[model samples]
Target: MSPIPTGRLFRTGTGSDLVLSRTFRASAEDVWASLTETERTARWFGPWEGDAAPGRTVRVQMAFEEGTPWCDLRIEACDPPRRLALSMIDESGAWHLELLLAEADGSTELRLVQHLTTEDGLGETGSGWEYYLDLLVASREGGPRPDFDDYHPAMKAYFEELPARAETPGHVR
Candidate 1:
């Protein structure tokens, strides 16, 4: 099956925001653990260690990536069972990301948003988030983790086309 690129790009104060969301038939607390707790996150994204707070930094390993590259993530905000915002800087540049959770009728919706400063790397960056989010779904629901290869080239066009669509008035796709 092809990877689904269902993210929406919206104009934000900084630049643009790429938002991807998934609704799970699980409690917000459970979903929150998966997102914040190190052991649970290792199943989907990667493992992280360090004191986590609004102004603290944590070292996270990109377990799925080759060489298991590690990066320092600065916690920007933390609202338990609701929202968590973090930032990181690497060779590419600075990245600001947020994870928001809302629960209704025993189901939780997780929204992962990346605040973009430029649209240059949307294709690669968006696809990576899609793949990782799907990995989160699989880890929770019990299934094989998705392969990055399946997401990149296949979902590239869909993400690359988002910026232009966001600019056009009345365009909804």
Candidate 2:
């Protein structure tokens, strides 16, 4: 079965944010490692190199992507185990992203927000994130990795329709 797209779009002063979240039965600190630590990240997203500090730039290998491109990401904010904000520019465009973590009742929830300049191509963008985040989950669980084909075209329509649905009355974000 195709993965269901769970991202929601919210307008912001700058532009808009496409938000998605996942929950894990792990501490925030553990989840933080999965996001920041090079070895842990390599299991899912990709490994990053260079000193990581607020206002500093780091090179991250897009290990799963074709050609395994490397991109420079500047860290904007870092509040250990709680919040992290970053920005990067590549051929695709400029991307501002934030990851917020909250833990309660022994489970941690990771919320990812991509600050988008325009809503164009949300289908492709949102699907990409869904695939990556699921990869994180699978890596952590040592389960089978998800196929990108299951997410992209399969989820394209759902994400493409999100903006219009958000405008409807009585819509619950």
Candidate 3:
């Protein structure tokens, strides 16, 4: 058989839909709790600095193999156990992320869609979202944590690794 195919994880400035979405196995309440609760969020997403309230400005510190990126996180919107929206900035540009939780079977489906404004290199900003969102999946499902925070420079490495891998019949490797 021939080798499978895989899409590049961090193809900067790619895709008309600058969105990297993931639907993992979990419950809406479980996922929602982890995201809204700062203490729980710290265990997975980032630092446990403060609360993630709507209209609240929170500071999230993420570091990678290279350095840390300190960003001003603004909670643009919130809906209990359902949806949470955030707006943040980086060296590239402004990023808008809306995480939604939908009921699927006995479990819940968590989807994260991001909108990168014209500023960060290309509209395909926040290379870390895909990785970090996976982290969220693990955290909500009572699984292990993810490696390598702060996807800035690391994203380049991940981007390189993805395209060369094999892909499943209907899934990306």
Candidate 4:
């Protein structure tokens, strides 16, 4: 069975945001470590090295991507254990992403928003984030990582239709 796509696209005056969230039964500080600390991140997304502060640039290894490419990512903003914003430009184009963390009742919710100038390749982009985020979850829980094949083509159609579905009356945003 295919994994269900959980990302939602919200339109804005300038463009749109592709948002996906994951809930963890861990403290915000712990989740923040999984996102920020290089050693922890290496297990899920990839390891990053540099000064790592707002306005600083870091070299990150896309450990899961083809060829395991390296890219320079700039830290747009960082509010420890709460919010982080980053931007990078590569052969694929520019990527602007933000993560917001909220904690309540001993659980933390990590909300990821990708600011997009256009909805051109959401099918591919959306599935990619889903796979990475799930990898984060699996890393934390000591579970098996998700297969990309179970995400990409399987969930592509759902993401491709989100813009149209969001336009329909009574559609939940």
Candidate 5:
């Protein structure tokens, strides 16, 4: 199967939405709590911290084999289980992840509205989010999870070629 995140890249508005929504057969409580709970977030997303309760700093030291997604981000927003936002210091405000959570069928429909303010190198950002979100889905459902932040050597190849794996041609967004 394809690695993930294989779609045409399009330019968007200043707040153009680059959203990725998925329904997990998991608990809203588990998914929401993990957004800001350091240990939980670390398992599926990176630049981890031991805690995320507001005011305290959460470090996300992300480096992905010079391919997939590469960045070192600092904790920007931590609302825990209900909302969570984080950004790269270098590209602060340029790219952000707004985690919105809602309850459904005794499960959680975690909506990750990842907004990339600009088109410059955002494919990498989206790809990384795509990969990590996969892990989130797996974890939220008690499925197997890949290394969310390790960024092993082969990851770069997957990131570089992700678009090619799409079932449909690139569409304008």
Candidate 6:
């Protein structure tokens, strides 16, 4: 298997975003269920419960975290089998995230983008996403969950070194 993939950073008028993606040899519908279904998600990221709809809030358990803390997550958008956008606020501050799915030739690619208020915590944030996303892959593939240690401090420098994206008058450079 390949190592964790690297993400590209982009600067927008509101803030910057760090985008990472993983490809799965499954249909978009299957991948979408793995992302949105409570039981499916529990096998990977965590489980969530509450009225699920655009603008509604749900409580999600960070199962892999030290204390398995529960956090409130708001659903911003939910276009099944294609895209889902959500946000959360915790001790770390507000986080806006989007998951986009594209399928081709019987495979689906999941692109996860986290809107950043600042580039300050890219190292920690990027590593956390990498680990969780990989866990999603393992869960879908029926493989064992990977150790977080393999992604953190070890992958810190790589994330820290990602270039800052600057936009020109008409386009991003």
Q: Which candidate has the highest lDDT of all?
A: 2
User: Over all chains combined, what TM-score does candidate 2 have?
Assistant: 0.95
* lDDT (Cα, tens digit) per residue for candidate 4, span 104-146: 9999999998888989988999999999999999999999989
User: How well is each residue in 76-123 modelled by candidate 1, as lDDT tens digits?
Assistant: 999998999999999888899999998999899999988889988888
What C-alpha lDDT does candidate 1 achieve relative to the native structure? 0.89
Worst 10 residues of 2 by lDDT: 164-173
Each candidate's TM vs. the true structure?
0.94, 0.95, 0.64, 0.95, 0.62, 0.92
For candidate 6, give the lDDT of residue 137: 89
| Residue range 85-137, candidate 5, lDDT tens digits | 76555543445656777777886777676555554444555666667777776
Candidate 6 C-alpha lDDT tens digits along 74-135: 99999998989999999988899999999999899999988777888788988889999999
Local distance difference test, candidate 3 = 0.58
- Once fitted onto the true fold, the runs of candidate 3 whose alpha carbons sit more than 4 angstroms away are 1-17, 48-51, 63-66, 119-127, 141-173
lDDT per residue as tens, model 2, 31-131: 99999999999999899999999999999999999999999999999999999999999999999999999999999999998988899999999999999
At residue 52, candidate 5 shows an lDDT of 45
TM-score of candidate 4 to 2 decimals:
0.95
Worst 10 residues of 1 by lDDT: 164-173
User: What's the lDDT for all of these models?
Assistant: 0.89, 0.91, 0.58, 0.90, 0.56, 0.86
What is the number of residue pairs that collide in model 2? 0
Model 3: per-residue Cα lDDT over 1-173, one tens digit each: 21111112222333222345556556678768777766676766656465667999888766321375667889999987888888887775667777777778766766665543332343123355655665666676777655544444546544444434423232211
Candidate 2 yields a Cα-based lDDT of 0.91
Give, for candidate 3, the lowest lDDT window spanning 10 residues: 1-10
Backbone clashes in each candidate structure, one number apiece? 0, 0, 3, 0, 6, 0
The alpha-carbon deviation from the true structure for residue 167 of candidate 2, after best TM-score superposition, in angstroms, is 6.9
Ten-residue region with minimum lDDT total, candidate 5: 164-173
Off by over 4 Å in 4: 167-173
Candidate 6, residue 123: CA error in Å?
0.4
Error of 3 at 21 (Å): 3.1
TM-score of predicted model 1?
A: 0.94
